[model samples]
Target: MKDQIRSFILPGGNIAEIDTREVKACLQALMKREILIAGICAGVDVLDHAGILCDVKSTHFSDADLVTDKNVITARANAYVDFAVEVAKKLNLFASEADLQETINFWKHYQRVQ
Candidate 1:
């Protein structure tokens, strides 16, 4: 699973149902290997609580927002387009123009639905 994971995308919402210690440990380990860990909306709280955002500029669902930092990319809610693009870039998943366009199209449809 570790080798298979090029990045970890954390979604937002009330995360009280999550197992923080396990999540933190996993995130730390992934980050140690320089894996891209992205947090969107309240998901940034998990990264923050993990102490992984110590020296990293990050943002959650707040009025003010910071851009990317270290291997972490964060943004507020409703910024899924930026978040997804960042994740794709970090993981080097966009190999061709078609791939990139596909991602854009996906998000465009998603936005319309939302």
Candidate 2:
């Protein structure tokens, strides 16, 4: 489901709907300073679980509050969109215009799913 959106939103950006099971390998790529991302919902959970959001302030859907896992980015929503703009704004700070263009193209491609 999410990959469909990722494919459309990132056209030529090498968008990947990496499975949580492979997050360890994914994290290696993410750790590189050049990698920019916008993780949401389970995606956010994966990053938090991996100890990357510890100090970033992201969000999740669980009623239970999160613990200080890898310092965790305290998110503001249970749903993906809640942190979307925030994440995008952050990504824009580093990504190129072409990257954003590809990202939007990917989203436009997937918008039909809803």
Candidate 3:
């Protein structure tokens, strides 16, 4: 993991310093489309650091231990959805009907590559 971190940093990839221990940075990065974001189990913790979550609704419990700012809607259970919206809010990436349409279009195109 540190090696991966080093590579991204060596390139100075405009990456933000996010606490990966809880998934905050990862989610924020994805919301902004700064980095292609995906994770499982612990990796999702990094997104939590950026104030995001995963398929939280499916789980009644979590092991994450991180936080960003003081206030905002947080993941009650399903973090992926919450995080996506949060990312949109952060980048001003999604808002209104047009914003939703744009997000859907972007995701549809994005998933094709993945």
C-alpha RMSD of each candidate structure in angstroms: 3.4, 10.5, 11.6
Tens-digit lDDT track of model 2 for 30-109: 54432444454455555656556544544443443322223133342343332453346453542777876676667657
Error of model 3, residue 71, in angstroms: 3.7
Clashing pairs in 1: none
**Which one wins on lDDT?**
1
Alpha-carbon runs more than 4 Å astray in model 1 = 60-66, 97-114
How badly does each model clash, as a count of residue pairs? 0, 17, 21
Compose the digit string of candidate 1's lDDT tens values, residues 6-111. 7887888997865379999999998899888888888888888887788777774336553687888998887877877877777778998798988888877865
Say which prediction, candidate 1 or candidate 2, comes out ahead on lDDT.
Answer: 1
Better of 1 and 2 by TM-score: 1
TM-score of each: 0.77, 0.38, 0.26
Q: What value does the lDDT take at residue 31 in candidate 1?
A: 87
- Candidate-wise lDDT, in order: 0.80, 0.43, 0.40
Best by TM-score: 1
State the RMSD for candidate 3: 11.6
